[model samples]
Target: MLLALPPLYLKYFEDGYLLVPGFWTIFFFISALTLIVFVVVLTVQQKNNEMYAQAFLGATTFKLLACLIFVLIFIKKGRPEKLFFVADFMYLYFLNTVFEIYGLLRTLRNQNSK
Candidate 1:
């Protein structure tokens, strides 16, 4: 929820700068999906290091490709405010990437300590 505050505030109170229609719904859905993927990947990681590595790499690649497709579709059918979409997309993408990395590092640190 913390990740959503700025966007939510902007959308409702700040003249909706850097946002598109249905932005919150898309943001929340993506965030939830990413969280689910991370949890599943981490659970698998705990069972087998080899599979963990492969799963992690595979998940990352899949996410990148999916995001690319989403961007393409958005460009084709999205609103006229292209620049706002870019800003919103980057905000979600980079922050989610950071969270994913942090989760991976935390899990690794726990594994190492054990």
Candidate 2:
């Protein structure tokens, strides 16, 4: 699926900068998908939500950092390219998707345990 994007993305890059590499789109997609595995793994991997949440928070913080860098780059350019401005949000979106999935899984576990 990822391999399918570059030519199409390049076709549209004329419309605007892609911000992150084409590879990251695949990575974000894959990473977001892992939350199901994450939830399943949680049953055996970590003993509690706090540990998982902490790790997830740290990872999400990194995603935000990557977005912030692109934002800073866009800011430094002064003109602020519209494509990057929008692309920058993908990081937040990816992080939010993962965080929400994790949160929902945790909630489900807590509810089920009770």
Candidate 3:
């Protein structure tokens, strides 16, 4: 939710310059995917620490593929403008990727300490 504020503010207050159509849908999809990946990684960490790296790699690959498919479909169906596409891509993928890394690192740190 915190990641949503900047885009939301830009969309509403800045005349919707940086947002594409269906921004909420894109946001929710990424959010759900991130949450699912995080949960799967943590479950793997708890169940088999030695397999954590493989699980994380698998999850990351799945996320990238899913995002690629989603972007292709969105481009075909939504026909969003180039600027909107760039903004949406950065917000949806880049920010989420950063968040996922931060979350994974924090979780791993906590697990190691315990």
**Local distance difference test scores for all models:** 0.79, 0.54, 0.87
Instruction: Say which candidate scores most in lDDT.
Output: 3
> lDDT by residue for model 3 over 53-103, one digit each (tens)?
999999999998988898899889989988878777877788888899999
Among these predictions, the greatest TM-score belongs to 3
lDDT of 2 by residue, 62-112 (tens): 655665675566456555555664555554455556565666677668856
TM-score for every candidate vs. truth? 0.87, 0.39, 0.94
* Candidate 1, superposed: residue stretches over 4 Å from native: none
Better of 1 and 3 by TM-score: 3
lDDT of model number 2: 0.54
Kindly report the root-mean-square deviation of model 1 from the true structure over all alpha carbons: 1.7
Total clashes, candidate 2?
A: 0
Please state the error at residue 59 of candidate 3 in Å: 0.3
State the lDDT at 35 in candidate 3: 88
